[model samples]
Target: MLTNIFIIAITAEAMSGALAAGRRNMDLFGVALISFITALGGGTVRDMLLGNYPVTWTQHPLYIYLTIGAGLATILLARFIHRLNQIFLVLDSMGLIAFTIIGCNVALKLGYDTPVVIMSGMTTGIFGGILRDIMCNRTPQVLRHELYASVSLVVAVVYLTLMSLGVSHGVNTWGTFFFGLLLRLSAIRWKLSLPVFSYSPGRWGD
Candidate 1:
């Protein structure tokens, strides 16, 4: 079940990356490159930080093929895909939640504490998009808009709470997944965002 969700999450991330590449008028190679990074960057970072060698895609080459294939498919269906913006947003939201859950689980299995688990979840959920945005020279949506990383933190907390209450793995997983997704989608629909931080240079000087 987790494997299936991970696959879906990576596929959605790849497509989103490809769409961003297209919007930037990138070539096929660029599209594939961004897609790979967007799909694997977070997991790669998590594994490296946890000292889990060999990394995920290195162990499972099929994930690489899947992300590249999704990117190519997005290129072929770019026009049709452009018409499904809302659907893609929902998919992206699901992907974010799925990544958060997977990351939290990985950290928990490694005997990490609550704060570390939440940080791991947030890293896995947002780092990929951050890398993609940097590569594309745009402000990351996670950093600028909506409650993206906050949603990931919420997923981690909810999962941990559920587990403490003796909830079954399946229920805990799906419950966190849907709750995070709904919260993220609601934020998107309602233009909700965290308060922005700013520094007034003149005031600081004064």
Candidate 2:
């Protein structure tokens, strides 16, 4: 269930990013690169960190094909993709929630402790976007005041706690997904932000 949800979310994100690349008038190779990174970059980082051999894409060769197909599809569908900003935001939020849960679950299955799991989950959710943004010449959104990575962190801890308390796997899975999703949506809807530096000059320099 989670797997399928993540697959769809990844597809959406890849397609959205591909469309963005196309809108920027990038070439075919550039479009494909952006789509592939947006889709598989997070899972690739998670697997490498966990020392999972063969990586997710290599293990599931179909993922590569699907990513390419999705990219091409996005190129064809670009004309109708008028709401670029909204699509990117929605797909990114979904991708963050799905990848975070998957990361936490993978860590738990591998017998890692809670702190490790939480960090892994956060990284799994955000690093892909970091990479993509760098490639696309934009600041990474997770690094901003926007409660982005924080959402992944809080939900990961919630998932870990629930699992530790003997909650059913099914319950923990969906609960974390919605928790992360709500955190992101609330942040977006309310324009909520983490406290920023007040820029007291002497505080840092003196």
Candidate 3:
């Protein structure tokens, strides 16, 4: 369930971003490249780290086709998509939830320790957006302020702890996803930021 939602949300975000790029007069190749990267970059990294060769989309070619179809559809309907930011925000939120769940799940399946699983989850949830930001010439939020990656890490640890205590997979997955999603949405809506790290001049020199 979480994995499927990740795929769907990513496809939508990729399609929208591709359409936005195209509207700037980019060529088809450029649009496709952006869409493909946005859709699959993080999952690819996660699979690679897990030694899951021939990743999910590669095994299921339809994932590629589905993203392509979404891209084409977005291009056709871009004019109709008022308030594109709203669409992106909702999809992005869903993607965060889904990706974080699947990441921790995969790590757990691989027989990793809980700490490693939590880190894996954080990587899966944030890396693709970091890639997208670099490609689009923006600062990746994962490397910036707020509780973004920290939230993902915390949820993963909590989810893994629950599972270790014999919680059902479904409950553990959905519960963590919702908790992280709601927390992130609230952070965004309220402009809630993580406390900034401050250092004394002497400490900095040391």
lDDT string, candidate 2, 116-154, tens digits: 899789878888778778788887867885789889988
RMSD of each: 1.7, 2.6, 3.4
TM-score each candidate: 0.92, 0.88, 0.84
Residue lDDT tens for model 1, 105-168? 8888889888888888888888999999999999997888988888888888999999999999
Question: Which pairs clash in model 3?
Answer: none
Pairs that clash in candidate 2: none
lDDT of 3 at 73: 71
> Model 1 clash pairs?
none
Give candidate 1's whole-model lDDT.
0.89
Candidates ranked by TM-score: 1, 2, 3
Question: Candidates 1 and 3: which is better by lDDT?
Answer: 1
Best of the candidates, TM-score? 1
Give the whole-model CA lDDT for all candidates, comma-separated.
Answer: 0.89, 0.82, 0.75
Residue 39, candidate 3: alpha-carbon lDDT: 74
Worst 10 residues of 1 by lDDT: 1-10
